[model samples]
Target: MKITPLALAITLICVLAVLAGTTAPAVASDAGGIVGGIFGALIGTVREGEARNDWQKVNREVKTCLSKRINVSIGQLVQKAIDPTDPRLRPYMQACEQQVAEANAQLQQERRIAGLRREQEEAAKEAAAVRNAHARAQKVARHRELIAKYGAKIASDIEARRVRIGMTKEATIAAIGKPNSREVVPPSNELWSYGTKRIAFTNGKVTYVGN
Candidate 1:
C-alpha cells in the first residue's frame, strides 16, 4: 500500500473519478470497468520507471503512511471500485492525503536550495570584481610614483626596453615596471628576466644587464 508519487497521482485521479460516479458499477461487469481505465491512462503517460508528473517527493514519507496502510497496493484497485461506505476506503484515503503533503514539503525544500545556490554564485562574482578593481588601482598608483621619482627619462627607458648596470632593483622595476619572472643564480646573485632581456643583481646592486 505504498503510495508513491505515481500512486499518489493515480489514487487522486481515481478518487475524483469515483466520487464523480454516483451509481457506477464496482466490478468489470460492463465496458466502463471500475478503476482499470484510470490506472491504464496513468501508466500510459510515462515509461515503466518514470513518474508521470512532478509529484516525485511523495517517496520520503514511506515510514509514516506506508508502514500502516501496507495492503492497498496500486494494481489491486482495478478488481473492485472504491465505495465511500466501504470499511477499507477511509485508511486508503488517509494514506493518500499524507503522501500528497510529504510531496509538497519536498518540493519546497528543493526550491529553497536552488535559491541559496544562486545567491552564493552572485556573491562570489562581486568579490572577484572588487579584488580585480583594487589590483588595477594599486598598479596605477605605483606607475605614477615611479614617474614622479625618475621623471620622463625613466618613463622613456621603461617604454623603449632598457636596464643599466648601476640601477637598483626598485629603479630597474621603475625602468621596466616588472619582470615576467625572477630567479636566484647561486651565491646570493638574483636574475630577473623581462621579455628576452636579463638583469643580474648582487648584494642588492645591479651587476649584469643584457638582452
Candidate 2:
C-alpha cells in the first residue's frame, strides 16, 4: 500500500512511545540532545545506509502530512505522547492535551461564525430578489393600465414596431413596455433611460431619442 503522511507521522509517534517506554536511555527529538545523539550514532554503526534511507522517507512523508493535517496530527501526537509508562513523555503531556482542546474549541467557534455570516448573506440576497419581483409586478400592472387607456397608438406602432418623432408618453410606454429608469432633471426634461438609449419628452410627447 502507498504510505501516507499520516501513516508516517503515526509511525514516528509509535517509535517514540516504544523508545520512551524502554529501559534504555531517553530519546529526545532534538539531534543535539544526549539520547538523540546516542540513537543516531548507534544507527550509523548498524546498516547506516538503510537507516538513513528509511529516515529520509519518513521525513518526506511527515512534511507532506504537515501541510494538510498539522493541527490534527499535532493534537493526536500530544494526546498519545502522555503515556505514563514513559516518564520522559509524561511531564508535558497534560499541557499539550489542554492546548489541543483549546485549539479545537477555537476552530469550532470560527466555523460557527463563518456559517452565520453565510446565512445572513444568503438571506439578504433572497430578500433583494423578493423586493425586485414585487417591484416588477407593480410596474407590469401600471403598464397594462396605461395600455388599456391609450392603446390605439401602440397598436399602430406595433404593426411597424417603430417609434417616430412625436409619439406620446403612453404610446411610448406601450411600445417599449417600461424604461429602466425615468429622469426629470433641469426643469424636468423628462428623460427615460433604457439601456443604451435615452428618450427625451416635451409636453408628454417624444421630442428626441438617442441610442
Top-lDDT structure, candidate number: 1
Over 4 Å off in model 2, which ranges? 1-88, 152-163, 169-211
Give the backbone clash total of model 1. Answer: 1
TM-score of 2: 0.37
Q: For each candidate, what TM-score against the reference?
A: 0.40, 0.37
In candidate 1, stretches whose alpha carbon ends up further than 4 angstroms from where it belongs are 1-87, 151-166, 173-207
Cα deviation at 159, candidate 1, in Å, is 10
Report the C-alpha lDDT of model 2 over 46-83, residue by residue, as the tens digit. 44444334334433334234424434443343334322
In terms of lDDT, model 2 sits at 0.62
Q: What 10-residue stretch in candidate 1 is worst by lDDT?
A: 48-57
Pick the TM-score winner.
Answer: 1
